[model samples]
Target: MKKLISMIAVAALLITGCAKELKVTTAENLKVEYGEELDNTKLFNAKESDENVKVDKVEGFDAKKMGEQEITVTFTDDNKDKEEKLKITVEDTKKPVIELKKESVGITAGDKLELKDNIKSVKDPVDGDLKYSDKTVEKDGYYIDKGKLDTKKAGTYEVKVIAADKNGNKTEKSFKVNVKKKETAKKPNGTGNSNTSNNGGSSSSNPSNTGNSGSNTGSSSGGSNNSSNSNGGLSNNGGGQKPVNPAPHQHSITVTGYPDVVYSNMWFEDDTEAMYWASNYEGPNGDWAGFGYSSDQCSCGMWSPYFFNVTTWE
Candidate 1:
């Protein structure tokens, strides 16, 4: 029985005087191929013996040579009479590696994200299925897909990406996202007010023409100090009569009019008709005496006529 059989010398064809006989004995019929190895045992289709057992030239491929490689196989008969060989090649049919590009991102609400980096451009050692996330946000030349990230809400969020090839190779990565909050603007004066028209209807412009709010007291400027009212005081468009006085309405007047401010002594609105009272004091009966709006400049002085009647008594 010859154990180590290889391509060897062939006997010459015997020839007679008139004719010649060629002896071409066919070697055992065998097949061979190489493929990626799996973690578990694998079975290759080869001719089997009558006992249903594999009787090929090779037993099995070594797991270590799982990558692209070449395998040699031979087949022989039970009598160990002759043998033949076949060469097979194994290769990886999986795409290259994929990973996250950017590690972190900071953005405000209503902002969109672009996961361009992590998207796999392409890797080597491939042949079979090479596909990216179908659910990704595709753009001009980028594939953007995230596991868990919503920018609408205000808070920190995390985004992750995963990729796998047909060969069962997998890769995953993540990112940090910071979202900003929205803000609203506020009015300067800190108050909202409008006045009525002559016919007591809503008017775009309030004819009342107030000097502002706080403690203010002053006589009429250019306009007639006294109008045709029951009381010789400035009159509302309604013909209502109210006396205008020059008494300071508030203790302190933060006048935006003058470059400088008039922080009067607290006693300004306190003494006699004075409306100033450092501590909270309504009045001998009701609220304060003459305090209402900021002091408006008048020929007489700074005073708010609209506050209380300038004439008559308290």
Candidate 2:
């Protein structure tokens, strides 16, 4: 009777051991992906006891902290207490961003123009103060429609932008910079500066000019472009090389050979004779002894039409 009783107790203990060794499955499948984040603590497993009893919470088992779901399940008489560790990794697959900015305006050729911009598009893939260049006339992205246009020259300038993403994915956008000749500067009074100068044929405000009787043509105003400099800025005033044109050595008359037009612009007969060809200069009074040009449109020694040059008079 004593031996039978002892055997019954041992059988009960063995059954309990087998129940605790049952393997448990996680409530949800372990998942890993790029650009995704998960809680390290709540990831857990689901299972049943040997009697098929469902488990709610294990007394001291934790599923979150190991940076992934990791747990060891021990097997009993039914198995060799096998244990395994599971991992849920998050992958990195996001790319970076890029951008550009500048002012807006129309452009023309034969007219000096300037292009300028500050590259400031931001993104995680690249460093700050990002650098980019382009030729598109549009406002943003890789293309810049604005730039310094050399009005004297005509053609299309290709605008391109090259940049890299966080994963080193290279991107480039291109646009066209067209340059063509525009209309000449209009004369004053909406008539254009071609036919008249300041004071309307009376004032030679611009010294180099004489009298423009034929018609005032070919002059510019308000047409400008940014200058090409270290900082990339707009350039309105012209800053370049001169054509090496020299001043005339002697003065010659071109009024169909006015014989009285002397080399010194004097009649030479006398101060009174000087008055004869006085009309050759400018002013309605026909004064010649003035030594200085009266006709605001003072032609060059080579007979080249004198435009408007304020520096020539003084």
Q: For residues 1-314, write the lDDT of model 2, one tens digit per residue.
A: 99999999999999877774445443345554433444433343423323332323222233223334444333232443434344453333333354434211224545554433333453433233333344332211233333443445544455544554333434544434445444468665744445443323433466455456334443334454322333223222377653465885554444432323223343232222232233233333433223322111123412221111112222
Which candidate's TM-score is highest?
Answer: 1
lDDT of each: 0.38, 0.38
Estimated TM-score per prediction? 0.31, 0.29
TM-score of 2: 0.29
- lDDT string, candidate 1, 232-304, tens digits: 2225756555556787644233345434332323332212112212112333455444332223333334332
